[model samples]
Each structure stands twice: as C-alpha cells, then as structure tokens.
Target chain A: MSLKPKTLVDFSFQALKANKLRSFLTMLGIIIGVASVILMIAIGQGAQAQVMSRVKALGSNVMMVLPGALGRFGAGSEGTAQSLTLEEASAVARLPYVANVAPVVRRAALVTHGANSWTTTITGTTPSITAISSTMSTVEGRFFSPADEKSAAPVAVLGQTVWQNLYPNGSDPVGTTITIKGVPFTVIGLLQSAGASMGGNNQDDFVYVPLKTAQIRLFGITFIGLMEVQAAGQKEVTPVINEVTALLHRLHGLPPGAPNDFTVRNLSQILSTAQDISGMLTLFLAGVAAISLIVGGIGIMNIMLVSVSERTREIGIRMAIGATQRDILNQFLTESIVLSLTGSFIGIVLGVGAAVAVSAFAHFPTPVSSLSIVAAVAFAIFVGVFFGYYPARRAANLNPADALSYE
Target chain B: MSAPLISCQELTKSYPLRGMEIKALNGVDLAIEDGEMTAIMGASGSGKSTLMNVIGCMDRPTGGRYLLDGVDVMSLTKDELAHLRNRKIGFVFQRYNLLPRMSALQNVLLPLVYAGVNAGRAANRALAALEMVGLAALAGNQPNQMSGGQQQRVSIARALINDPQVILADEPTGALDTVSSAEVMTILKELHQTRGVTLVIVTHEADIAAYCERMITMRDGRITGDSIIKGKRGA
Candidate 1:
C-alpha cells in the first residue's frame, strides 16, 4: 500500500514543525544566497541600463575625433592640446558618408546673470551641433542661428542646469544678458535637460556660444578642441570612420603606418565595451551567490543527515505499519523541498524589497526582472532535490528490525 | 484440515558479527491455525524475538520456507513483503512505539495511512479502534502525555487498524507495571476471544504466557517445547 501524495506532504509539514529552530537555521543559508543573487543581478542590470541611457543621449551612428590617442582609462589628457582645427573638421565633414560635423571648444568658466553666478562648462560650437546630438534641443526661444556663428555674435544658449543655477527664480532668461569671464552675451535659448551621462558628468550643465566668438573673443584660441561626426546612416559608420581617418592622415601629413595624432572612437564600440564589462560583473556576482546556494544545499544535507539518524526509530515504526522504502524517501524529500522553497519565497520578497529600497535611497535604477526570479526559484528546487537525496536514501535503506530496536 | 494461517519450515536467520556467524534462529518449524492464541517464552537471545520478526515480515530469514495466509513469505520482494505485512500482520512493541509527535488517534491511524485509506473513513475507524481499547477520550493526546498502559493500548489500536489476520506482540507488556500489563493482556485476550484473531506473544514472563491457550518454550536458537495448557485451551 502506498500513501497519497497529499498525505505525504502533510506528514512532511508535521515533521518539520516538530523542530522549528533547526529547520529555520538550515533555511537561513538559502535565504541569504537567494537574496544576494537577486540583489547583485539588480545592481548589475541597473548599471547596464545607466550605460545604455548615456549611449542613447550621445546619439547613434556617430564617432568622436579627439586630439591624441585614446588613454588606458578613456579620453586622453591631451584633449586640451591645440591639435584639431576648424579647417580639419570641415575637411572631414566633406568626406563621403559623413552627414554633419560639430567642432567643439570647451572651457569651464564662471558665468553670472544679474546677481546669480555659477561655474559651468562653456561650450562653443556651430548650429550643426543640434543635428549631431539627438538629445540637444531648445526648450525656450531658439538655438543660435548660422548667421550668428558667421558674424561671431555675442549671443549665448543656456543649458537647463546652467539656466536653473543662474536664474533660480525660473524667469525667462531668453532676452537677458549673461557675463562669461567678464564678457557679456545675450541669452538666446535654453536647452532641454539631459540628466547625467555614463561618466557621471552633468549633460545639462553647459553654456553654449558661437564657435568663432569663443575662438576669437572668449579664449583667444585658434584651434578647435574636438569634432563630433555623424554618419549618413547606421551602415555608413565604418565607411565614414575610414574616410575621416584617411583625410585626417593626409591633413596632418602623417606617413603611412604612423600612429595618427587624433583618436577616432566609435560610439557603438564604447557602448558594447561598457555592456561587456557589466555583463561579466553580473555573471561574477551571480557565480559567487550560486556558491552560497550550494553551501546552503550542503547545510540542508547536513541537517537532513542528522534528522534521518534521529528519526530512525520513527521510520521503523512507519515501516512496521506498512510504509515502504519509497514512502520514507518521499517523506524526507518533501520536507527538504518545502524547506528550500519556503526560503526562496521569503528571499524573493526580501530581494525585491531590497531592490526597491536601493533604488529609492541610492537613486540607482534597479529593475528586478521576472526572469531572475524564475531562475532563482528553479535553482532552489534543484538544490533541494540534489542535496536532499543522500540523506533520504540513507533513511529509506535502514533495516527495519535494527531500526526499531535502536535506542 | 486447511493450511495454517502461519507456517514455518526449517527457518534460519544468521548475521556476521566480529568475524563470526551468529545464529539468531536455527531450523525452527512451527504452525498456527486461524483463531489460535499462542505465546512464546524464552530468555534473552533464545530466538523467540527472531521468530516473531520473521513472522511479522519485518526481517527475512537467511534460509526458510514460510507462508502467511498460504502465500510464500520467502519469495516476496521487499515492497510486496511490506504490503503483506500491512494486509495480514500487525506488530505491537514493548515500548509502545507510537510516534511521539502525533496524537494518539493519529498513532492509531498510522497503518491505515499506509493502507491508502481515505482520511474521513480512516479517522472514524481510528476512533472506533481507540474506543475498543478504551482510549477514545485521549485520542487527541500525544504518546508522551499518556500512561504506559494507555500508550500500549494506542499501539494495539494501531495494530488492529488494518484488520490484519495475525498480531505479533514482542515483549508487549515488558515496560508496563503489573496493573497496566494486566490491562494490556486482558485487551489482547478479549480481541482474540471475540474476533478470532491469531495472536503471537513473545515474553519471558510466565504469567503473561499463561494468558494464551498454547505456549511454546525456546532455548538457545531452537524451540524446546510446544503444548496446550489444558485449562486455558480456548479459555
């Protein structure tokens, strides 16, 4: 005679209830393991999403040509070197497959509007910067016109962060005058807010002026800082890069096989590189967390082994009454599965709660995927069955006569 | 005329202990017809408990030709033997082997659980068995809360739950006081008289053995005597 499945499960619950402390202690390992798994994955995915948003803000099918070679960490310190020129930017812009070019020269300066003053990056670029940066747009008034750039006009555009800092009263600064390094320029527009980039730099914290105005009036510098180049289409990015590289090589008079003075970095390449690093980090964290689960499984096995020996006489009594080896095995197996699944359920709740708390307090984007939850639960069951088998088998294999006679 | 309810021919059981083969049972041949109440008396290691275990289907004999209800016990697999034990043989231990965590009623219904009985009917039958043993009022109490006699009665009710043909009691009253022992013995005798259940009790106590009609004496690993007490026959 075999027991019904429902009866077996009931028996398991009763047995677990007999020793509450030991059961919870055994489940603690699993709880910690599951919680960390979910938390680590959430953090990893959040960082990845942050990187993706930064790439989106930087626009697509684009590349940046900066002075000097790319450094080990990122953009080289030689960025301030006067190597790139407006003529070189125009030359690259005329290349086939190149769509728009925005030559940029930037410097941090203290800008004042009325009594309010703020220190922010002052960027000087042509009107084509609006076409090159997909996120850049005027939220008030208008961007500086091509005619303003040609005449080196003393008109300025305020980024959202700069506008808020310089005009804390929220009054329109479109017709107001702002002084940058003691030079007065009329505020002609305000750019929409773009938040922060992957490098944690404020994207909306700059004041824009005409390229010629900054070159001739503000900084007295003749060379441009960098060039933002956009491809005609997604498929033309590589061709555009190759053409730009050749054109720059000829313009710089660099011999063939000589490393060029400028660094041409593809935006998508940086995006994929960021994604790879974060993905590896997620896997590494998960691997460490999985080890804890296995450790938890081992803890279960240890406790179950103790339980089996402790219940030898009880097992004998059941056997004498009519329970078969399979029944005994199933009873213990069910107990362990219940233990792990209960732990996992609590872990899921705790993990999700912790994710929300981190997002709320730390301002990190942590989207707990349903897939991770599913995977954690499935893995917990596997751990329960895998580690619970040996002890259950030992219990099932006991000789009834000897077991009954055991003290 | 018909085959005995339990039959044993040349049954032997041995185990290797410390590089020596120790014989627990040696070449014992016995039979008990349906409705027979018999007692086996022996000192420690006299093979009576071994014979009881063999008959209870809790242990297999190293060599034997045995039958319970005309089915060859020696040929049955482990699971089939368990099923046979559930269907035909019941066991009552000296320590009143009721699970400590379960209530008295749950203890009584243990065999029916393995017998695949439905819960509602099983509970009713368990209460009925408890009532017969006069412990129905204490059905919800765990074994630790009950007296020795009450615990033994609960175990007896457990043994009777499946309505098996034979009941094997090994030192069933060894752990009880004189009053509790008498109470247990009276219950067993009443069940045997009223239901015609075959009863096999293994005890060293002479008074306990006197409750049975037939008594068998064992020495070492073999039976020495088998006889019906004249006055106690069918008493």
Candidate 2:
C-alpha cells in the first residue's frame, strides 16, 4: 500500500533528527558547492555588464579601423603589426555616407607648467573629433580650428582633470601655455570632465593637440595608431563601414578573398562580442563549480547507505507492521530530498548575500539574476532525487526476516 | 459452517545453510478457529517463531496453500500481503520495538498511519487503545522513559490500534519481569475473551501458554503435540 505523503515526510524528518550532526555534515558539501557556483556566476555577470557599459560610453554609431589585419588573437595585438598614415586616414574620409573622420595619434608625455609636472596621455586629432566622438565637449573657450590643425600650430586642449591638477586654485587655464615634451603649446580650450569609464580608466587625464604639431613637433612619427569614423545616421553606419572596407581594400591593393591590411569594427559588435565571451566564461566556471554539488550528492548516497544498514532492525519492525517496500523507499527518499532542499535554501541565501556583500564592500557591480536562483534550486532537487535513489533501493530490497535479526 | 479463520496445508519453509538446506518448517499443517486464543510453544530453532512469522504474513511458506479468512494468502502480491497485515493482523514483538524517539501515543498511532487513517480518527483511536491498555497517563512518555511493563503495554496498544482480526504476539513477555509478564498475559486473555479477536502467541514458558485455549508444541521444525486447555487458567 502507498504510504501517505505526510507520514513519510514526518518519518523522514524524525529519522534525520536522530542523526543531527551527520545530517548537517552531509548537507554542508552541497551548501558550499551551490553557494560557490552562484557567487562565481554573479561576479561574471557583473564584470560583463561593467565592460558593456564602458564600451557604450565610448560613443554611438562610431567605428574604428585599426591599421592591421585583425587576426584571431585580439584587436590590441593587431595594432603593433600595422600603423595607419595620414594619407590613409584622409583617403577614408572621402568615402560616402561618412559624416566625419578623425585620425588619432596618441603618446604618453611629461607635461609641465611652473613647478608642477605630470605624466599624461597626449592625443593629436582635428576639430572634427568634437563632432565624431560623443564623449568630447568643451566647457571653457573653444576647440582648435581646422586652420590651426593645417597650419601645424602648437595648440592644445587640457582635460578637466589635468587642468584641475595644474590649477588647483580653480583658476581658468584656457589660453595658457603648457609644455608638452619640452615644447610649448597654447591650451585653447578646457574639456568637461567625463570622470572614469567602467574599465577604471580616468577619461579626463589627457591633453589634445593638433595632428600636425603632434606629428612634427612632439614625436616624429608619420603613421597614426587608428582612425575613428562617425556615420551620418544610425542607418548609415553599415553603408559607411562597407564603403570604408572597400576603400581600404583597394588602397592596400588586396585581391578578393585575401585578408585585408586593416580591420574595421563598430561599437555594438565589440560590446556583443565581449558579452558572448564573458557569458561563455561564466558558464564554464559555473559548470566546474557544479562538480562540487555532484561530490556532495555522492556524500549523501554514502551516508544514506550507512544509515540504512544502521537502521536495519527499524526497517524490519516497520515492515512487520505492514510497511511495504515502496513505503520504506519513499521515507528514505524523502529524507534525502529534504536534506538537499534545506541546503539549497541556505545556499541561495548565502550566494545572494555574498553577491551583495561583494557589491557593497568590494565596490563591484553584482546583479543577482532570479533565473540563476531558480536554476540552482531546480538543480538541488535534481541532485537529491538522483543520489537518493540507489540507497533507497538497497533498503527496499532487504529481506525483512534477515533485517529483523540484524544487530 | 464457516471455514476456519486460518488454515495451512502442508506448509514447508527452508533456508540454505552453507551448501545444503535447513528445513525450518517441514510439511506442517495447522488450522486455527476464529476467536480462539492458541499458543505455539517450542525451544529456540524449533520453528515456532518461523511459524508465527508465516502466520503474521511477514514471511511466505515455500510450499503450502495458506488461507486466511477463506482467501488464499499465497496467491496475494507483496503489497496485498502488506495490506492484509495492516487490516487483518497486528503484531506485538518481544522487544516491544517501540520507536525509541517517539512517545507512546505516536508509537501507538503508527499502525493507523500505515493503514492510511486520517489524523483526527487515528489520534483518537490511538488514545482509546492506550486507555484500553491502562497506559493513558503514560501516553506522552517515550519508550526509554517508561518501565518494561509500560513499554509492553504501549506496544499492545499499538497492535490493538488497527483493530485487526488477528493479534500475533511473539514472546510478548520475554523481556519483562514476572509482574509485567502476568499483566501482559492478562491483557491478552481479556482481548481474546472480551473482543473475540483471534490470538496467536509464541512462547517457551508453559505458564504463559496456560492462559490460552489450546497449546501446540514444536520440535526440530515439526509439530509434536497439540492439546485443548479443558481447564483454562483462572477458571
């Protein structure tokens, strides 16, 4: 006869209570394993979101063509292999559907005014940078003009942070002279502070100079690092990218099917690629952490087997009183499931608590996804049912007469 | 006339010892009338316990046609046998075997729980059984908290809670003192005569067997003697 659910549950609870310490030890493994898995996934998701947000902060509908044949390794590694010249940047600017293009040349240089000296990034670009990049805007004075860029004038725009550091008294530094690598340049404008991006990079820690002055006066280099192109509209980005790729391919004289000498990537594509990699990495780590749960399940099976043997006489008594094999099986199986579910409840609370703790104390962004919580709970139930089956079967298969005789 | 409540024809039970087999019950036949209190007495290993186990439906005979209440028990499935044991048979073990962690009330309610009785009626019936055994005051006590006699009474209460047609007691007084043993024997006799329930007791003590209506003796897996108690105890 089928035993009542309430009876089986109560019996299981009482049995577990009889061996309190052993039951707790059996549940500990599952708690630790599930908690670790959840924490790792939460951290991974947090990092991915941080990266995506930083990428979005760069600009919209803007694409970069780095001067190399982008390979399987990464875009950063490709930059050392190739460098774009001003000629190539100008050639791309003439393409249709392109709203504006800025050829960027960057270098780390020591800048000094009075007795104060600081190491800061110096970027050489044109006035079109203000139009092409969403992050660039002036709060004081105005940006250098196209004529100033063409005339190779030694002019500059001080970043908000560099300006503040140099003029801590809050004096206006616009139109003041700052030495770049021992060369004097006039600061024609002041940029609004953009603070730090999600990557922890200080955005307002640089100075902008004319492309010609930076190339000829600061550091003698004919090639630029990369070029940024902004499309006229959101719909124009694909056509602009196609035109640039075709233009660069012809300029480098590459045949069809041959790899291009340069790589063009849009902002959204980079964001999604970053997301995919991080997502894959999270799953991989979560999968590894899930192994501990399996180990915990094995521990449960071991304990349950020992418990069955220890309670052989009890089983015999219950059987003598008309407990069917299925009844015994149900009771033991219910005990195991109850064990894991208890562990699961505690693990979920701990996992989320750890996630929130990390976010609060460690200054990381951790978003606790409800889907993961549900999945973890479901997995705990699955573990219980899976591991509880074997020992329960062993108990059910025992002979009542022999069990009665067991010491 | 109604058939006997229990009838076994040529019942045989054997177990393998090493390579050869040891017969525990050797083609023994027995019949038990309804409302009759019978005692099966024998030395250890003489098959009295095995006989009781078979009659209690805790084991099946290897070769026999055993009938209980005119139904073939040998033809029943394992679950059917369990149901029959729950509904038609109650067992009181020598050790009392009350789950030590449970109170007397919970222990007594066990059979009803297995019988799928609802909470309210099961609890009420368990209390009534405890009251019948005169242990209603000790119903809240665990087995360890009670004396041997009290524990035995609680087990008897458990056996009676299901209101089964047959009560099987295997050395019920074996673990008790003289006073406790006499009290248990009195309860069993009262249950038999007052309730008209069939009672089967397995014991080696002749004094305990004297309270029954009939006595059957076994020797080396075979029945050697059977006699009706014409002058029953206390009569």
Highest lDDT among the candidates is held by which one? Answer: 1
Chain B structural similarity (TM-score) per candidate: 0.97, 0.97
Candidate 2, superposed: residue stretches over 4 Å from native: A68-97, A106-123, A130-145, A154-209, A217-225, A233-235, A247-260, B18-20, B231-235
DockQ, every prediction: 0.61, 0.54
The CA-based lDDT of model 1 is what? 0.90
lDDT per residue (tens digit) for residues B1-235 in model 2? 4799999899999999999999999988899888889999999999999988888888889997899999999998877887888889988889988887999999999878888888899989999999999999888999999999999999998888888899999999999999999999999889988999999999999999999889999998889998898534333
Q: What is the lDDT of residue B172 in candidate 2?
A: 99
Residue B80 miss distance in model 2 (angstroms): 1.4
User: How many clashes would you count in candidate 1?
Assistant: 0
Predicted model with the maximum TM-score: 2
Candidate 1 per-residue lDDT, tens place, B1-235, comes to 7899999999999999999999999999999889888999999999999899899999999997999889998888888877887888889999989998899999898888888888899999999999999999999999899999999999999999899999999999999999999999999999998998999999999999999989999987898999897534343
- Estimate every model's Cα lDDT from 0 to 1: 0.90, 0.87
Model 2 residue A2 distance off true place after TM-score fit, in angstroms: 1.8
Task: Compute the DockQ of candidate 2.
Answer: 0.54
Per-prediction share of native contacts kept:
0.78, 0.50
Q: How does chain A of every candidate compare to the true chain A by TM-score? A: 0.81, 0.83
